[model samples]
Target: MANAASGMAVHDECKLKFLELKTKRTHRFIVFKIEEKQKQVIVEKVGDPTRSYEDFTASLPADECRYAVYDFDFVTEENCQKSRIFFIAWSPDTSRVRSKMIYASSKDRFKRELDGIQVDLQATDPTEMGLDVIKSRAS
Candidate 1:
């Protein structure tokens, strides 16, 4: 199939690389970035649940990192959970407001699998989600 946005046909070679991104089933948590239009899933990562909620990247002088979680099971079309995403760039005195979020939807979680489906707040991103799944596969 062709990518609707880029109009680039996903070749057999491209799919082989995508297959490498597959996450094996495990007791761990998994995250998937699914392109609804393309029906292609980019399995992100799997990680320890206890270690997923916090930041572990080397603190950079320019780029900052933070996370957010969205649960579709407990979310409704009208009312929703309020959440925040912070990306404090630079130092303590010169940080930039990178990204922010006050709400999350179940629709966002529908495409990904995580431990205890409904409570994935600790599994911040797809990479963490993938880690959890990979861990499950190992055991």
Candidate 2:
């Protein structure tokens, strides 16, 4: 596929890496960055995120980090109870400072937005940022 705005073909080799989300089930997160001027996409892994919201909040810088609980979920499957929470943290004007933490469930929650862009603020989220999904099962 091509980026219509730049008339540039989005290459397959651009995919970089994957991150295994430390959720109840087998979940993974992928990252990608597209530089239209550079004609390149960089991919990478996110690793296991902090399972506790408190630890995550405590680690962030008070003045520089912005946080939000995008949404929450109560999962009941096969006698297993798990809570999936969607959230985000970003630094407004800083480099390498944006994150959209989400979960995978087969249900709808609600609609949300950040920085003028619609985000997946639901359990069974349907959203993507840039070319991150180009090399994943979601793609």
Candidate 3:
């Protein structure tokens, strides 16, 4: 019984560490177009919101920046101006096997993919491995 409990604790610790690494590796990007007439910048995040849906929008605290620069183009036809801002964040993609393999390799770990199944490089046969087993092995 104690062995089982200790094993569960170890599993939980590994799960938490895995999630921490995943979040650390996750990337976020925002791209939007702004017109000269536009007074405010609108932003939205996709996924489970920490706050209520209604309160999420209101959660964006307004701030004023003293120094700002923008490179904009003029629309001759409409006699207006606009700019497109691209905010890019690059991080690892954990969904795909290749990406996972790359990340693992970078960390001095190795992974292997066989017949559409992902497994540790040490795993000789992944035929019997399920999603849960593969995930546990990823740690």
Task: Pick out the ten consecutive residues of candidate 1 with the lowest summed lDDT.
Answer: 83-92
- After aligning candidate 1 to the native by TM-score, how far in Å is the CA of 81 from where it should be? 24
State the C-alpha lDDT per candidate.
0.28, 0.29, 0.23
Q: What does candidate 1's lDDT look like per residue over 1-139, in tens digits?
A: 4344433232243233223323322212223333335544343333332333322222122222222222211223466643221111112222333221211222232323222222323223344434344333222
Runs of candidate 2 with Cα error greater than 4 angstroms are: 7-27, 37-40, 48-91, 95-139
Candidate number of the best TM-score:
2
Q: Which is superior by TM-score, 1 or 2? A: 2
Rank by TM-score (best first)? 2, 1, 3
lDDT of 3 at 137: 42
Native-structure RMSD, model 3: 22.6
Q: Which ten contiguous residues of candidate 2 have the minimum total lDDT?
A: 102-111
Residue 116, candidate 1: alpha-carbon lDDT:
25
Q: What TM-score does candidate 1 get on C-alpha atoms?
A: 0.24
Give the per-residue lDDT digits (tens) of candidate 2, residues 1-139.
4433333343343221211232232222322333436543333223233343333334334333222332122334465554433444333233333222111110112112112212332211213311232112111
Candidate 2's TM-score reads 0.30
Give lDDT for model 3. 0.23
